[model samples]
Target: MEDDIYHVVREPEFTALFLLGADDLVETVEDVDAELRLPDGTRWSASFMTLGAVETVMNRWRETGEYGGGVFFRCSDLVIVPKGGVPAMIEAFRAIVADGPQETLGNLG
Candidate 1:
């Protein structure tokens, strides 16, 4: 699968930084049947109700390279070292970010 063809990296550091900043501003990850708290006082008691979206999205990128709806820019950052042609790279990218029920990640519903 493209998972092997493309060695993608979402940069946990970047995600951490981004989410953490949002946490600082918004202050919580609500709707998990409970409040999902981030480090410190960032409470998820409100906003971002679709926690499943989180797992769904993160796993989606793992399966394909682009992340659903093409929101994840990191896929573009990944290199096909040894310089696999652009078509192969694009194919691999699409393979990673396709929209569907991911097997290992399970259904969002």
Candidate 2:
């Protein structure tokens, strides 16, 4: 993970910065771990995973004997999106934020 490189996107209400991995391609990335700065100067973190990406990870975990043999998928600060790419993720985050469900993301101190 290259912490220095970030994909910054500014929305009307918030600004999001995604940490890109060494081999990550922004246009095709299905899973992203991002930090969002809200209007109140508060930062929140969330992991956005597409349905397909979650299934793929679970299947791989089954083979590797992880996460109860891949029977269940759990993430503390997870926002599962229907599609891949950063745009979809940013949209989801925006929706979640606008809907007043801050619990969907973890607050960063």
Candidate 3:
């Protein structure tokens, strides 16, 4: 069975969140340029992620019909723009990817 966990982590400029779900090992930083935009109104271009994170995002899409276009991605405890109000979600995910956190790792498994 797949264990899915969802929660929000509020920050000064970003909303850090995580979601875990069933299927596949997503072990790679994915460039979700087509799915998200940067602060300057540009596509997000980078591959920063883990296997578990990718699985979580994919699972969310399959179940909720969200981010179906592959524009956004979830990385363990890092969710970029879940509510879609602020532009800081992208930056938050980047920061977490650069520096692994206990919270992020906790959701990996």
Candidate 4:
């Protein structure tokens, strides 16, 4: 099996500062349902709900300054590092956000 790779689809001028700023704007919970461990031994975890919610907040903040909601993680706290490359991480997070809790969790009837 191969690890999934996601590419950042944002504007070409997007910089690390923008991603860092978005990271600073997030709030993570103490518990997480899913996690990804990096090659460096660091772990990243969060529920489908939390990831989706934070993605919404980040998108809003990026497009407009009308962001007033909070971002959080469920199973574990949300931590945004440039591991796996900043763009790849950002894109993966975006995909997770787009999938949302219900879809990601496969809550289909």
**What digit string (tens of lDDT, one per residue) describes model 4 on residues 1-109?**
1123211133332211122222332233221233433333333343323344456556766666553432332323344333323444445545554455333332212
Tens digit of lDDT per residue, candidate 1, span 10-93? 322210111222222222332212122222333222112233545466667767765554455332122222222222333333
RMSD of each: 19.2, 2.4, 14.2, 14.1
- Alpha carbon lDDT of residue 69, candidate 2? 92
| lDDT (Cα, tens digit) per residue for candidate 2, span 1-109 | 3335788888889988998777777777888899988878988998988889899999999999999999999999988888878888888888888886466788896
- Model 1 misplaced regions, further than 4 Å: 1-49, 67-109
TM-score of 3: 0.22
Winner by TM-score between candidate 3 and candidate 2: 2
Tens-digit lDDT string for candidate 3 (32-83) = 2212222333322223343554666777677787787555664443343333
lDDT of candidates 1 onward, in order: 0.30, 0.85, 0.39, 0.36
Instruction: List clashing residue pairs in candidate 2.
Output: none
Off by over 4 Å in 4: 1-75, 78-83, 101-109
The best candidate by TM-score is: 2
- Model 1: weakest 10-residue lDDT segment is 12-21
TM-score of 1: 0.18
Query: How are the candidates ranked when ordered by TM-score, highest leading?
Result: 2, 3, 4, 1
By TM-score, is 1 or 2 better? 2
Residue 31 lDDT, candidate 2, scale 0-100: 82
Order of quality (lDDT): 2, 3, 4, 1
